[model samples]
Target: MHPKTSSALRKVDAISKLLIHTQRLLDGPYRSKLSVSTDLESSLSSCKDQLDYLLRKLEVDFTQQPNGKGRRRDKLLRPFKISSHDLKWPFTKTEAEDIIRRLITAQELINRALQVDQINVVLSVEQKANLEKLPVANGAIFNSFEDEGEPECLPGTRTDLLRDLNTWIADPKETRIFWLCGMAGTGKSTISKALARKLS
Candidate 1:
């Protein structure tokens, strides 16, 4: 609870996370054979432990710096965090790490987005020469909260919803958040699985 001790812990946590993600980036694509010497998974496991420890430490009380006449942007800025608990499907630790990295990047992207009046993603080889060159939301996918709409009969037959998934794939721009309602006759999980497979 001491300020100095808490601050030191905070600093340590920040550096550890930075190192972990940097390592992940250096490791390159998932399951790349380039990973040698140190095992990829063991390293990840250690990093996860470090992160968990930090989170537990964070649960104790701490104080942020008092707002002063700092940079104007500092006053405007707000912290960003994704609610992992809200996911319909729970992710493995590895998946969670990737999601955390993405959420961090997305927070930065939104900051950049605010400054730039207009931003449209255009995929080009030349553009991907560097990290900054990469398009924001290049491969991002998300589901939305389904709103009130006319009940269109659940896609396809009773066996599987793979039939109507073709339509979902055709539209790349939209993020469909499906809310499955109704009785046993309505194929909720089936439709979700088919949509997931199609996306995959």
Candidate 2:
């Protein structure tokens, strides 16, 4: 009924909501590899208990007081005072804010750690060296086609040819010899290389 009691109850609700949301984040979204550390989880549980106790004390002390203007409410609020000093509501509010801030900071740190771990994937020295090298080869027949850019298939150049070749190769009903007949420089070698790449 009193403003102070209402404010404290609101703060308690906020804190509870924050804790629930944080628990969901830790349990659901970050459940796999980015879970919160066990120590943090324990500390959060303790904070939750402390907040629950404070809320219950506030409810019992304020709501059960006899209807009196001045002395009775102060007397009821005295026994369960939040702090030794005068400020009651601010202390709990500040504490809840601090807890939420710490939880958010911990979440950010865990996300950053996950990003770093993903970036630093394990690779052998040979694999690393292979990644660094240019992905090109210069074999005998392919060397002749070096002038036509790297031996990768040019896009949209040989659709019908590739389809026919694929059909011939996949003809399990009969053994067949495929002949790709085209004049020189009509991209015969290029088609062959592309087909080889597709088959491989």
Candidate 3:
């Protein structure tokens, strides 16, 4: 075969493989193993085009930015301002179902992390907000735990704990207890003191 013909044949093969993979991506697993599909991959673009068609049919938007932030930032894709409006919504039902999936994923991740015990982690502002948004039942009573005695709180740490505690209280979840666990000398006692002052 001619050299040029060989190269062209290779491109065709690549495109053919891409089409088959992309069809699978659209059918069941939207969670792409690949980071991002390039525009040159016509199959990927075609799948997205199908997403756009379904979005238009429903009129909810496939890539509408929930907060007018250009595009709803995908979990893995950060610092990308690419508009989802042109990208596609995939399905309306998937949006809600994906939220539940993400929540379960995160909860499992947290539990798995806690199993290690030595690894301490902090939730990002957005993660914390989403966790707080988890629904609660009606008539759920919130009982604030109180420790009787002089608080052992230190300096301005009281201020920080007060802020966090106030937020926990403001939340409407059916939280029976706030497990403020930490190692010794990690200021758990200090925070307990601060909570006492705020409660008092």
lDDT of 2 by residue, 1-200 (tens): 55666765676676677667656755775444333332357656865776766676664533433456335556655888732234344336676556546545555544555455345433344558876795665563443554456455579877988988888888856555677787887877778878876876
Q: Which candidate should be chosen as best, given TM-score against the real structure? A: 2
> Which residue pairs in model 2 clash with each other?
none
Q: In model 3, what are the clashing residue pairs, if there are any? A: 62-89, 63-84
lDDT of 1: 0.45
Error of 1 at 92 (Å): 31
Query: How do all models score by TM-score?
Result: 0.25, 0.33, 0.23
Q: Per-residue alpha-carbon lDDT of model 3 for 115-136, expressed as tens digits? A: 3322221234456787789896
Report, for all candidates in order, the number of backbone clashes.
1, 0, 2
By lDDT rank, best first, the candidates go 2, 3, 1
Error of 2 at 158 (Å): 47
> Better model by lDDT, 1 or 3?
3
Query: Candidate 1 regions off by >4 Å?
Result: 30-33, 37-40, 62-200
